[model samples]
Every structure is written in structure tokens, then in C-alpha cells.
Target: MRLFLLLFAAVFLPAMGSSKAVCHADVPCTLGDRSYHVRAPDDWDAATPMPVLLHFHGWGRQGDLIVNHGRIAGHTRNRGVLLLAPNGLGRSWDFWRAGSRDTDFALAVIEDAAKRYPIDRSRIYVSGYSYGSAMAWRFACEGGDGVAALLAISGTIPQDETCASHPRDIRHVHGLADPVLEYPFGPGGDPRGAVRLWRDTLGCGAGETAPDYAIRPFLTLSRTVWDSCAAGGRVTLDTHPGGHFIPHGWIGWQLDQLAGRAPRYP
Candidate 1:
């Protein structure tokens, strides 16, 4: 089609033969009036297919800033995984219901990006914090085949919202003392039920908990995993003693776990 060529010429051409990413820190890839940020992995080869992680930023924040954070960038860089983050309209997301604007845009970004680069389609991942994490939940519900897994922190979907019966590899982290989104239950919905929705979709049995699962250096976590399900679906919930926040080395650790390089449980 005529339109397809125009897009390919615009998006795909520039990405070709460039060792660096099309978008990176302090720079953005503009799509219409909206923009997103990307950080390429260390020692990346242009001809090789690379895995990518799509991280949604929290309310009132831009994706540009997230790519600059050491917690996210430094960790993923070593794994050769590109960090792709989209800027939400008005610095926030409309994620309560499925088929929302942000979710649709996020999915389109995946399809669009795949054309521009040698993307490892089977390794696409989704993650978020606070309101962004809520978007992750909604995305899992509607993201279709574009999403491989989710790493959610401090958020959940709306209690009344319903999701497609699809299996996913989800690892959600929440602090029991979190006052902002709260724990187990949040202003949006009960995170336990959110985990349950995916668990049931996979037909996994009751969660097996490791009371003192320590992934990070100093912090001890309560890790629950459900692995006995169809299509190798896995749902893990990691809770800590602190409040609403990302435990040190937590995000990167999950990336390794999902890659089967690190342990998912003790």
C-alpha cells in the first residue's frame, strides 16, 4: 500500500544501519504530537534481533525521564534489552477500562517498532509503577500477542473491570505498608484479585509461598508463585515489609528471572 511505504521510508529507513537507537535519553522519537523514549543496550549489534521492554511511567511523568533512571536503564543495558517507554497524554493514562487510548497506543507502538528494527517479538515485556502499573494490568487484559510478560509495582486494575481470559507471565510487587496505592487492596482495586484474575486464567493452583524469599541484598520478600497452568503461564507476587516503592535491584532482577537466568523463587 502507498501508506505502508511512506511509513517504512520514515520509520524503518532511519533505524537501518544505525548502531545507536533511533530514540534515546534527551532525545525522543516523535509520533504525531506525542513522543516516547528508548535506551539501547550496551554493545548492541545492528543486525541482531534484540529483546525490548516497554515500561509505562507513572502519572504526571514522562517516559524520557524513566529511560534516564539508573534503576531501569543500568540494569537492562547489560541484558541487551532495549527500554521503550511511551509518553502518556497530559502526563497520565486512561487505564481503568479496556480498549482505552493509552493501551491501544502502546500496542500500536509494538507493531510499529517491529517494522523499524529486528525486534524479538517473543520477548516483548510490559512494566509500570503506580498509575502506570495500572496501565500494565489493563494492557495485559488487552495487549494481545504483543506482550510477553508484566512487571507491575504499586498498582492494580479497577475492581469492576473485566479482562480477557488470557494467560500471562506476571510478576507483581507491592509493599504491604504502601499508603499511596496501599497494599493487597488499593484505591483502584484489590491487587490480590488482580493476581487472581491472571492466575485463574491460567488455571494455576493455589499459590505456593516462600515466606522469606530474599532476592535483593538486604530486603526480605514474601514470594508467591503459581506455575502449574496451561501454556507455561506463571504468576508471581512479591511483597516486602516497606511502603509503595521499588526495592533496590528489583526491576532488573525480574528481567533476569523472566529470561530464565535468575531464580523466580528461593
Candidate 2:
């Protein structure tokens, strides 16, 4: 029994330690005064480049809060995509702050990730909820040089913002019953207008009518896709019957779209 226990400790303990080292739970990467949390899967290999998903939290929420409440880290981990959850200044993103360098901070985070890990530059994606969603749109529009795709949830671009960069694949997800950021239109801004801006910018033809599909018995989902666009750019709008929160299957479906495995939704 003693020898058996000795062998077990000699073999299994080291392996367990190695596994723990490979599967990082979440670690903070500090750049100047700002920082963000990064989590990678256990099977990550430094030699092979992997896709990265940088997620931003909504107003009054921090990076760790979204990681715990949003439950997107597990989805990204299952898909073998590195997850980056960046905390905005004072629990909110500075999207409209004139002197705030939030955009530069985001870029720095990506650059730091590339340096620290095997990040695929062509597959870098940005996603956010609520106020962070607005920042996501702003990021894609202004500094979308290396971003391959964007996922904006529960928010749209501000009316004053403009897309000065080239077109890219953008998917917007929102719930019709959201009281905070209402669907179709809201006191803050108009989602339809934002969708129209992308549609026109991407050079997509007139919108086509499509049937709404049921993701669940209670949650009916509809998708508006702009198929014909320049530079392979596509704009998609997904609406569901819910409130100011992301659906459970949204992250997985976004991963599928990125991997080219399945359509935008199940």
C-alpha cells in the first residue's frame, strides 16, 4: 500500500500540476494603469495560433462580473478560443469621453495578448453587452484594422459615431422586450438606423423578408441578413423575445459563425 501510494503521488501529482498550469482560470494583464483578465483553454498550444474573443462588460459592471454572470468564458473555452474580458474605467467604458483613451487601451490589450500568446490576428473578434456593445461598434468602426468580426449585444452605435474604416462582418443581437435598450427604437437611439447604416455601408441591396424561427418555445428568434455586400462583408441582426440580457445559445452560435460550421443560429 505504501509503494502504491508513492507511485500514485509520483505520477499523478505532477500531471495534475501540469494540467492546472495549462488551463489558466483567469489572470490579469496590466498595461500602464489599465488591466484586463485573460483565460485560455487547457489544450492551448503556443506553436499554433488560436482565435481570440475580447469581451467588454456593460455599464456599472466589471470584467470579472461578466465572466461570472454572462457565462461566456465556458462557451469560448469549449470552442478553444482565448477569452479576454476587459474592464472599463470605473466600471463603465469611456466611449464618448473626449480625453479618454479607451480605444487605445483596447488596442493595447490586443497587442499584449498577441505578444503573450499565440493569437490569430485574422480571427480576432470583439463582443460586448449594453454600453460595452456601443463601444464594440465604435471599436469596429474606428480601429477595426485587425478585427475579423464583431458581435454587439443589446446595444447599437451612437447616432454621432461614424464608420470611417472598411466594412467587416458585424452581427447585432438584441431582445425586443428590452426595457433598457428597446428593440426597433429606444429613447437613447434607433437600432434600425444603425442596421441601415451597416446595410448601406456594406453596399447590400434592399432587405429581404425572412421568417422568424423559434430558438425556444417561449423565445422566438428572427434574423435579418444582408447577403450581397462588398469585400465579403455581411451585416446580420438577430432579435429574440426577451429582455436586456444575452440568450444562452448566442455565444455558441457566434462561435459557429466564426468557425464556418453552422449558420448564425441553430
Best by TM-score: 1
lDDT of 2 by residue, 52-151 (tens): 8888889998777655543477577667687888879889877763334777788888887666667788888899989988788777777776788888
How good is model 2 by TM-score? 0.81
Question: How well does each candidate superpose onto the true structure, as a TM-score?
Answer: 0.84, 0.81
Give me the candidate number with maximum lDDT. Answer: 1
- Model 1 per-residue lDDT tens digits across residues 147-241: 77888898987645556734267888988888998775534664456476676666778677767766666788878888887656788988887
Worst 10 residues of 1 by lDDT: 5-14
* Candidate 1 segments exceeding 4 Å error: 1-14, 17-22, 165-167, 185-194, 230-232, 263-266
Error of 1 at 58 (Å): 0.9
Q: How many backbone clashes does candidate 1 have?
A: 0
For each candidate, the alpha-carbon lDDT, in order, equals: 0.75, 0.71
Clashes of each: 0, 0
